[model samples]
Each structure stands twice: as structure tokens, then as C-alpha cells.
Target: MEQIALKAEKRDISKKGTINELRRKGKLPGVLYGKNIESSPVAVDAKELLKVLKTHGESALINLELEGEKHPVLMKEIQRDTLKDAIVHVDFYRVSMTDRIEFNLPLVLKGDAEGVRMGGILQHQKRELSVKALPADMPEHLEVDISGLKIGDTLTVGDLKMDEKITVLDDPEEVVISILAPKLAEDTEVPTGEQAAEPEVVAKGKEKQEEE
Candidate 1:
């Protein structure tokens, strides 16, 4: 539901050379399309988009301003360079405020549980969830409090709260987060025979030195 303004410009020429040149100038090549809108190659400030991704973590909605028109969009796919790991291209879906849309919202745990404090390992199996809801009703994050969690306690999709307009795509009883038993270290160290004998020789050398 949080919105950030991004400035974009329509592209007349779409080619690999042009895109690479744009990247050299720190611009990101992207396409925006949805519903009845025509897909157009557009360019936006790369640094600004990176800042938004950092602040919103892919879950935050974007308000893209192309020329003077504002479009509410969701980041559909981001393509990064394999060697450089830099964002090369991005795909955005223009969304309507009134229509219901599905998104994979991230799950965040709040509070340190007693079980985790008691030598239990906290395991998060799933990071995001699929939910259908209106764009205005979409939550930035799905918070699940682990304060009451025990060693074997688990939180499932059904345990989470959703808006009346939201529908969850995952199984109701699917375990999302759980605490497991902490791994214990082995009791004894098993030394190799040759390495163990080398220690005795060093001890003998020390004994001989002491005798001198």
C-alpha cells in the first residue's frame, strides 16, 4: 500500500546497443504493460529503482510517472546480468486500484520466542505467500508473532490473519515457521593414529629439553 514516485520516459528506439548505452549511463530498461495497455519499452533511473527495492523489498507497490501520467504498477520480473549481477531489465504490471490482484507477500516474524531462547533453532520454511486481494487492501508484509511458540509449535497459513477481500492460495495447514531442536556437539574427538603419535614425540622432545 506504500507508494513511491518514480520518473520514467518512453523509448522510441529499442535495441541491445541502445539498452547497453542506457545502462552505461545508469539507466534501467523496463517494459510496462497490463490489461489493455500496449507494452512499451521505457527507461527509468536505475539508482532510484534500486533504492525503492531496498526500501520496499519487492513487496512495496510502485507509482511510476511516465511523462505526466501516473501508473500504479507491481514489479513482475527483474532480470539481472549473470556475471555482473546488475539489473539489466525489469517488467512491471500496471494495476487497477479497484481490481483484486494476487501477489506473493513476504512473511516476517516478530518477537523472540521462548523456545528459541531455550536452545531451539528457529526454522523458516517459507518466505512468501500467495494471496489474492484488492491492490488497496494488500498488506506490505504478513506479520506472524512467534512469542507464544514452543519448541514444537508451528505456524501455518491458517494461523495468519487476512483481510476479508484476500484469499490465500497455499494450503491452510502448511507449516510456515517452526522451531527445531538445536544440534548438539559430539562427545569425544577421534584422533588419527599417526597424528596422535606425533604429539608423544613432541612431549618427549620437551622432556629431553627439560632434562638438559
Candidate 2:
């Protein structure tokens, strides 16, 4: 729950051309807003923001230093350039340390599934779980061990162990992971329409012979 330090400058221009100009100068445009707080347009060094994202990820608390005033915030949304794979814009949500906030935590699978060794497929239905916790009590990730899993066994959200301070927001009955039975040859080798019709054609020919 350590907060990462970042600095941002207030932005006056919001036009598309101006935003592109800022990006060419290695700046990223963003906005900061929260309960009881007025929204403010801001910009920060793109390289610095990338470094913070790489180190702290999106769920961690950020100490956003804006014009000498420090705001504890969380990254709410990030828009990326799909082709260039660069951050285009971001949204920050200010938060109080003691307030409960909801966020998604990654699910980590530990240990190999016993069913996998038996030719079964290991499937993960939920890769992350939504949780509510205080800023200081948030966990980086949740883990589930699958070493004891057998074919047809399913692990649900209710099966996970969590910290007392953290409340899982996901449905308790929702599946998180499971070991599925191995696929049979027939299951994988479905016959084409023509191939399937051949058997029906042969059956009809036998009926015609009996009639004759």
C-alpha cells in the first residue's frame, strides 16, 4: 500500500491540436477529480508516468503532487494508443486513506493441477476478483492453489481465503478456476455436413431395398 510519488502541472488548453502538441513534447494529458473536488485538467511527463505504471500498476495509491499540493489518488482509467502501444490519456480519482474503495486484484494460480497430468485441461473463468478495502489494506493480488484439483473439480470465489480487512465484491458462487475432463477423439473430430449426410443416405437406400 505504499504510495508512489508523481508530479503534474495544470493544463489550460484542451483542444485536440493542443493535446497532440503536448504529446509530441513527451507530455500526457489527464484529469483529476473526486468526491467534493472540482475536476482539473493536468499534464505530466509521459516517461515519468510510464515508470510509475510499470512499478506500481493501476491499483496502488499515488501521491500526485500538483503545484505544491499533494493529492492521494488512484489511476481510474488509462487510454492507450493501440498501434503505438503508448499511453494517450488518463483519469485520476482522489481518495481518502480511511475510505473503503473497490478495485480489481489479479488472481494468481499456484501449483500444477493434478488433473492436468491426467490429460485434463485447466481453465480459469475469472482472472481477477473485485474487492473492497481501505487504501492501506488493499492486496496486490490473490492466489489459488490448484495442486489438489481433479478432473471436473471447480473452484469458486467462496473457496478463496482473504484478509479480514478485504471484502470480496465478486459473486461467491462464480467459478474462478476448474479442471475439465479431457476431450475425447469424437469430441474434437466432428464430421462435416457431407460426411454426416452419407450415413443417412445409406439408411435410406436400405429402406428402399426392403420396400423393393
Candidate 3:
């Protein structure tokens, strides 16, 4: 919920070549818009943006310092280059601290499950949850403890302990994680002595009939 300050500058959105040139100069192209503000093209230092994201994560509120004004915003979308895995563009949504906003919150699992130690398979069913919270009440991520889970045990959205200020939008019955029994190898039967002898007896009976 801490607001991190980032410097941004207004950019011209006239040509694709200009956007490419901005990226070449180590600047990332982005758009800033909201209910009260008009859509505007902006640019920020690519390295600085990455550093902020790495340190505080995308859930943290950002104070975008543009010209002499600062806009309270959230990182809405991030586009990346498929091959190079580089950030290409970003979208910033200006928000009010008092208004509630909905977004997907990442789910992080902690502690090794007891069932896993007993040869059980641990399945992570949900990686994120839809939540609605004020900007100041939002958390970076939700952590679920799995240390006490036994085989065939499941954790659902209803089991999550959340703050009173935040509301989870997902179905309460949706499963988040589960510990399953490990698959056992099929048993291969070895023929008994009598069973093996039965085939040899049938072969000898055919030979005797042919001799007769």
C-alpha cells in the first residue's frame, strides 16, 4: 500500500517511429488515463520502472510525477516482447485512494505440506484471486500456509483469512490448493507353479494324440 514515486514525462504520440526511438533511448512508452483525466501519452525510464516493480511489485500504488503534478495510479497492463521478454508498453490507471477497486491478487503458498512428505502430490489449483479493496488496504500478495495439510486435504477460497477492509470476489467454494494421494504402481502377478505346469500338460496331450 505504500506509494512509490516515479518520474514521467509527456510524450508525442504522432508516429510509431517515435515510440521505437523512445525504447531505443531506454525509455518506456506508456499511457495515463482515468475517469477524470484525458488519455495522455507518457514515458518513463525503463530501468527505473523495472526496479520499482521488482522491489514493490505491481500491486503497490505509484505516484507518477509528471511535470509539476503527481498522479496516483495503478499499473493496469504491461505488454512485453514475446521473443526478447522485454517490456514494450504499459498502461497506468489513475485512481482515488478512497474508492474501492477490483483487481486480481496473486496467491503465494508457504510451508511444505505434511502430505507431500508422506509421498502425496501437492496440487496448486488457483494462483490468484479476484479481490476488491481500497488502494490503501490492498496487499502485495496473499500467503496460504500448507504445513498442516494431510493427504486428500483441500483449501478453498472460503478458508482464506482476509482483512475486514478487503472483499474477495471469487466463489467461496473454489478450491485453491489440495494434497492428493500418490499414484501406486499396478501390481504384476507372478504365475503359480500349478498355473505354469498346466500349459506344458496341454502341449504334451496334443503330442500324444498325434502319436496315436
Judging by lDDT against the true structure, name the best candidate.
Answer: 3
C-alpha lDDT (0 to 100) for residue 113 of candidate 2? 94
For model 3, which pairs clash? none
- The Cα RMSD in angstroms, rounded to one decimal, for candidate 1 relative to the true structure is 5.5
Cα lDDT tens digits for candidate 2, 1-212:
78889999999773558888888899999999998789999999999998887776778788999999999999999999899988899999999887899998888899999999999999989999899999888776777899999999999999999999999998999999989998788878979889989999999999999999
What C-alpha lDDT do the candidate models reach, one value each? 0.87, 0.90, 0.92
The TM-scores of all predictions, comma-separated, are 0.83, 0.81, 0.86
Residue pairs with colliding backbones in model 1 are none
Estimate the Cα RMSD of every predicted model relative to the unseen true structure: 5.5, 4.7, 4.1
Superposed by TM-score, candidate 3 places the C-alpha of residue 98 at a distance from the truth, in angstroms, of 1.0
- Which candidate achieves the best TM-score against the true structure? 3
Q: What would the per-residue lDDT of candidate 1 be over residues 1-212, giving only the tens digit for each residue?
A: 77878989987573558877888889998999998789988999999999999888786788999879999999899998899978888898899998989899898889998899988988899888999988877788888889888887888888888777789999999989898876655436666789779989999999999999
Task: Give candidate 3 regions above 4 Å deviation.
Answer: 187-212
- If ranked by TM-score, best first, what sequence of candidates would result? 3, 1, 2
lDDT of 3 at 51: 94
